[model samples]
Each structure stands twice: as structure tokens, then as C-alpha cells.
Target: MNHSVTLKDIAKALNLSISTISKALNDSHEIGADTKQRVLDYAKEHNYLPNRMAKGLKEGKSRSIGVVVCSLDNNVIAQMLDGIHKVCTDKSYQIIIMQSKESEKLESACIELLYAGGIDGILISPAYETINFNYLLSLQESGLPVVLFDRLIDKIHTHKVGADNFKGAYEATKHLINNGYRNIAHLNTNTILSIATERLNGYKQALADHGIPCREELMVSCNYTGATSLNENLEEAIKSYMSLENKPDAIFTATDQISTRCLVILNKLGYRIPEDIALIGFTNTELADAMNPPLSTVHQPAFEIGKLAAEKLFSLIEKKNIDEDFETVLLPIDVQVRASSQPSNK
Candidate 1:
């Protein structure tokens, strides 16, 4: 095996003390510029790189942040990652990504591993199954600056960045109501995530504001099971709704996946969209425009939210304090009214 060169070897070759070589390599103010240049040039020539782990141990910083998301298969998360990458790259910081697959146990394990790895900070869009904020609180107490994005835990006092879900949902629901959708139903997710709750509240508030009574039975909660199971759940929910004495005239889906499933199920049941059942969705998915009738949707700034979260986390890492005066960031949502939600000329 080839032997690795060390600071001691470099010091011997340069006829300088190891501490002097170390200071020069670290670009410490104590070392003269000429000495620093010499050490850097020698290191480049010899392909000598300092051990990051040892340096991190000495400096109490890793220059690396851990990012955890529920699933990489999600397009929303993919866009968010692009934004995070842009910010981290500009700062010359490394990001370690971990997926929890919506499992709380796996999510906790990932957090523990990142904490043990001496990460300077953590950015997380927690698993849907994470109902409590204790684990996140523990991580904060352990001195790891954590920034929650997209999905959040209200009890945990941490900086968070996310779309204004309530406003988005309200606008989507109100749009449907304005387009003659009196019997509008909400296809809700089973998880009690803060974002989901906010969306539900928005839907309710919109209905109440329009003097429409909110019907509890019209809201169907489906387990978050990606596309396949989501289709199945929507089919069942539609069947039950159609069987009711007063069927829903429209639907406000909580996500793009739910909207797609709604279209499929409605088609399978021989229902004409807009004429029979109007639809509006949360995400601005590519398929929305390509559908038989372009589906209307509220667009969330996923990429911008991710970028802002990463930037805030870096700031927190440098400041080493969580701002107690931090308020919830409400990113703007754009409502695109399309053919699927077009009103009749009554």
C-alpha cells in the first residue's frame, strides 16, 4: 500500500514546525501570506489534503449540512432539492440527503445518524408519519441548527419556510365556488401535517365565507400511498359520494396526485368533467395542462421554498441562534383556472 503524507512530513520537508504548517494550511492570520502560499502550492503539488473529520473535530464545524425528505419520488421534493443545491453550492457547503420513505422510525434513525456524523446543521421536510415534535426538539437541544420546510411541526420552535397552504387552498376552493360549484367536496390526506391542516382550514373558511355550509361527510380522507393506492382510494371515495342522496358537484383535491386520480375515477364512472363535476387541484403538475381538459391548479413555489430554507439554515449555522421572533413564511400561490374548472354560461 502507498503511504499517505502528513502535516509532519510536510513540516520536515519545509523545515518549519508542524503548528506553523497547520496554521498556513488553515489560512490562519498568524501565518504570513508568503508562508501560506508556499504551503498551499506544496499541498497542490503533492496532492495532500487535510482530513476533514479531524479538522471538523478541532473547529467544531463540519461545513456540511444534512437534508432529509420523505420521498425522492415526489416532484415537489425534487424541485425543492434543486433550489437547496443551488444555495449550498454557492456557499461551498456539502449537503447529505436522506429519504425516510414516509416512515417515522426510519426518519428518526436518519436524524440520529446525521447528528452523530457531526453535521453543522440539518434541513428537513419530515415524514408524514411523524406526529410528534419531540425528536426534532431533541436535535435542536443537541446544538444542531434545524430548519423545517414544506411539512412542519407546530410545537417545535424552529425556523420554517413553506407555501401559504391555507391561502392556496382557500383560493382554489373559492375559484370552484365562483364557477358554480355549490356542492364542492375536499379530498383530504389522512396525515395531520400542518400543511394539510392549513389547507383543510382554508377550504372550510372559503365555504363559510361564501355562506355555504361545510359538509363533513363530503370530505374524504385517503392514506398517503403514492399514485397506485391513491387511485384506489379516490375510486372508493367517489363511489361512496355518488351513492349518497346528494352527490358532490365538484372536488377540490389536496394534491396533484389526488386531482389526477379524481379525473381517472370520474372518467371510469362516465362523468363529464366541469359539466358533471368540476375540479381544481393544489400542485401545478405538468400533466395538468395535457389532460383532456386542462386541469386548474394552485401553484406552490416549491423550488423557492427549498432555496429559502437552505439559505436560512446557513444563516442559522453562522449565527448559532434561533430567532425567537421568527414568523411563518407564507410563499405566494398562483391559481391557474383552466378548462376543467371553466364555468357554464348560465
Candidate 2:
């Protein structure tokens, strides 16, 4: 095995104290420019890397963050994790990622493990089945920094970052209406999280604005943590919508997974998009444009959300105070109109 050089090795070579070497490398005012340059040059020549973990431990920080999300299978979550990794790399910090698999029990266990593992902070996107947000609250109360991203929970007040779910869903629904799609149906996750409720309300608001009566039968919440698979739940919901006396001319989905999966299910069921029924949803999949009839979508700034969330968690950790007013950031979302949502006459 290759042995890595440590500060002690550099100190011994330079015949200087470890304290002086550390101060010089850190560019402390106590160290002169000449000394700093010499230390930097020698360290570079020897290919020395600072032991961040050790130094962070000495300073009462782990220099590592815990990231908890639903799953890495989704492109949206993957993009967000990419942003987090980039920021962590730049900051000389490491990230420990864990998946909740959209289960509240599993999400709680992840948080507990991260906290017990001595992570400096946590950035979590609550699972759809999560409701006992107080679990995170207990951790925050115990001085462990906590930040919420992607799916914001109002129960715990901390630095929150996510997309504008309401406006995103609203724009998708409104676009379908403008394109002559009436009797629009909405499909969302079976959860009480703000992300779900906000999107559902957005769809309702758009319908009301257009003088269309909101029908409960036109909306369905797909169960994610049930005995059946999410695919089966979605199929049942879609079938129910089609059986309605006044079937929707278009359907608006409320999440990244739901958005793309809805499209795929529709295709598998032999339904012609835009001709049989138009479709649009909030998704950030790269395959959207390549789909047989391209998909219209409400695109969220997933990467930015992740980046900001990680940055905010660091700020909170450094501040060592969560009593101050926390920031709730909602980044704007884009409505991408594609062939799947364009009127057939066009």
C-alpha cells in the first residue's frame, strides 16, 4: 500500500513546528508571506494533502454532511445529488448519501444513523410517507444541523430549499387548458407533504380561474407505501380517470417520478398522446424530448436546489445557531411545451 505524507512528515523535513506549518498553509496573519510560500511550495512538491477529517475533528466538526433522499434512480434526484457533490468538492467536504426508499420508517433510520455516525449536518428530502417530522426536530434540537430540500416540511423550521411546486403545477395545468384541454385530471402522491398539497392546490386554482368546476373524481393520489407497487397504483388511478363519465382530455402529474411514469404507462396502455389525451407534468427527465410524442413538462431547477440546500446547511452549522429566522427558498420552475401537449389541430 502507498503511504500518504502527513503534516508531521512535512514539519520534520522543514525542521519547523507543526503549528507553524499549519498556520503558514492556512495563510494566517501570524505567518509571513515568505514562510507561507515556502510551506506551500514544499507541500506541493511532496504532494501533501491535508487530513480534513482529522483537522475537522480537532475543530469539533466532521467536515462531512449526510444527504438523505428518496432514491438515486430518478434523474431529478440524481441531478440534485450531482449539485451537492460539486459543492462538497469545492468546499473540501465529503458527503454521505443514503436512500429512504420513500418510507417514513426508513427515512427516520437514515437520519438516526447519520447523526450517530458523527456527521456535522444533514440535508434531507422527506419521503412521501413521512409525517413525524418531529423526529428531525429532535435532532435539530439536540444541536445537529438539519436542512430540508426538494420536499419541504413546514413542521420543522430550518433552512429550506425547493422548487416552486405550486407555480410549476399551475403552469402545466394552465398550459393544457389554453391548448383547449378541458376536463383535466390530476394525479399526485398520497401524502400530506407541502409538495403534494401545493401542487394539488395549484391545479385546482388553474381550473377555478378558467371557470371549470373542480371534480374530486378527476383527481387521484397514488399510494406509494402500500402493499402494491407504485406502478400498479398509477395504473389503477389512470384507469379510473378513463372510466369517468367525462374523461379528462389531458392529465397533469405532480412529481418527477409520477410525471415520466405516467407517460410510460399511458404508452404501454396503447393510448395515443395528444390525440387521445394530452399529457404534461413536472419532470426533469432527459428522455422527455425523445419520447414518441415528446412530453410537455414543468421543469424544476433540481441541481440548484441541491446546491443551495447544502450551502445553507453549512451556513447553519458554522453559525451554530438555529434560533434565528430560517430562510425558505423556492426557486422558479419552467414550463416546457412540447408535442405531447400541443393541440392536434396544430
Candidate 3:
């Protein structure tokens, strides 16, 4: 008779009790198989939806984890999410994902919303603008398990899973050096990001090891966090590097978008890969192998990073008590050499 139907309505319609309808809907062992099927079918037909919060209160758990990431436009994040999904499925948990879009305000709001939604745990890849972890620390002190991945924050002690950015960047820069590419330029993001700072440190270390000077002028910031100025900043960075009387002989890009876009822009600017300049950077896109010169890349194990972070969060969720000591899992990165960064003749 009413537009909105409840479990009480379904029970009354079927001449049953509310408890019976509830148990049937929840697939309780006490309910007969025939009754369960009937209830499920009826609910499906009538578009009956259970209240998630109420269910969580009843079971004392939401059975869901909240995931926050910077963006899904990049293939690396997509692959990492796939891995997180796989782990969640295996653990009989669900994931609610949100994007911060590289804004700290959005990130803080996402955390508050996920906590209010009663998520049992959280997995976050911090945004470039995320500098404060006080909120996250308060959540942890309040017993909410949080796992940081990829773009991590060191202030909040929690489970961190990410690629070895330092090692990856070191190897990438060394690859360029081994290939006879001296005067290597680094395209890095804002130093606020742990990934950016770690990769830059590795790049500098590699240059020092190879007896090459770390030129400050050759280190450029593309400011990828702000999409409005991303292209313009990248263009200026490239033009500045090229304008030098003794420009860099090689370029090492720090992130996925920076790596791929630099190649495109370089080609557009009439520069030949590994001829006029060598290129290597961090990227996990499938297009790497199919590029015009087949880009050499420092490939982060995105899927593995996701899977590991999910596993760690689930461990914290299922375990009765965990140690105060936190874990930092630094997964290895793979350097795939290709035509773009082949040994230079000169």
C-alpha cells in the first residue's frame, strides 16, 4: 500500500515475522534455503535495499575499507586498484574508493566521510598537497587502522607499501649514465611528495656516484598537481633545459605523466630519442613498449603495491592485537631498457 517498503512490509505481505524476513535476507543458517531464495527473489523484484549503516551496527563491522587516491587517470593507479580489489575479494571485504584530485581539503574531507560511513579500515595514497597528518594520527589513536601507499606521509606511523622510489630512480639515472648520457636533467614534481623527494635524492646520488655534477638548473618542477598549469609548466621546463648553451644530454622523469608527456613533447620539438637526448623515467603504462622509440622506464609494481597494502590493512583488521612498531614495505622497481635510452654514441 505504501511507496516505500520495509522488512516489516515484506514480512506482513508474506504473513511472516520481521525476524524471519531479516534472517532470510541475511542468509542466516537458521533460515531454510527455500525461504532464503524466496526472500531474495522478492527483494530483488521489489528493489528492496538494506541500510548499510544499520547492518554494520548489527554486525559490529562495516565489512568495508575506504580507499583514497590522488587520481585514476594514470594507468598505475588503475592497476593498483585492480590489485586492491583482488585482495578485498579474497578477504570477503568490500572497498569504497574516493579520489582526492590532489587537494588536501578534498583529502581531509574524504577521510571524515569514510570514517563517518563506518569503514573498518582505510588505505590512502596521499595527495601532493597533503602536508598534515594530524587527522590521520587522531584516527589511528582512536583505533582506526590506516595504511599508506605510494604517495606516503612519514609523520603518521602506519603500514606503508610502495615502490622503492630511491632505488628505482637511482637505477634509472645510472642507466642513462652507463649509456654515456652525461649532464642528465631530472623532471621532478613538488618536493612535498615523498615520491618526488625520494626520486630526486636518488637522481642526485646517481650523478654524484658517476662523478657528474648535479646541476640545479637542470632540475625542473612540472607542478603536475595543478592541471591548469601542468602543460604550461612542462613546456617552460623543457624550453629552459633546451635553451641552455650546454643543455642536458639525458632526461630522467620522476612520475608517470611526466615521463610519457616529456617524450611526446620532445618528439614534437624535433628532438630524436637517444640521439639528440636520452630519456628514462618512471612509468607503468602499456604504451611504453609501443612508443616510437620504445621508452626505457622505471616501472613501479603498482598491482603488487595495492595487493600488499590491502593485505596489511586486512591484517590489522582481522588481528586481535598488533605491535606498536609499524611496517614500511618497499617493493622493488623494474627498469626496462629500450631504444629511447640506449647507449649514446658520443
Best by TM-score: 2
Q: Answer with 1 or 3, whichever has the higher lDDT.
A: 3
User: Considering TM-score, which of the candidate structures 1 and 2 is the better prediction for this target?
Assistant: 2
- The C-alpha lDDT values of all candidates are 0.85, 0.89, 0.89
Model 3 lDDT per residue over 64-170, tens place: 99999999898899999999999998766789999998888999999999999989999999988888889889999999999999887679888899999999999
Candidate 2 C-alpha lDDT tens digits along 159-250 = 89999999988888899889988889999988988899999999999999999999999898988764357789899988888887889889
- lDDT, candidate 2, equals 0.89
- Global fold similarity of model 1 (TM-score): 0.83
Question: Against the true structure, candidate 3 has what lDDT?
Answer: 0.89
State the lDDT of candidate 1 residue by residue for 1-346, as single tens digits.
9767799989999989999999998779999999999988888888886776777667778878999998887778888999999999877678999998878888999988998887899999988778877887987997778998998778778789999989999999998888778888999888878778988999999999999999988999887745677778889998888888988988899875677778878888998888878888887577788886788888889999999999888888888464545556769989988988885651
Cα error, residue 218 of model 3, in Å, equals 0.7
Q: Each model's RMSD to truth, in Å?
A: 3.9, 1.9, 4.3
Candidate 1 clashing pairs, residues 3+ apart or interchain:
none
TM-score of 3: 0.84
Query: Lowest lDDT 10-mer window, candidate 3?
Result: 318-327
Order of models, best TM-score first: 2, 3, 1
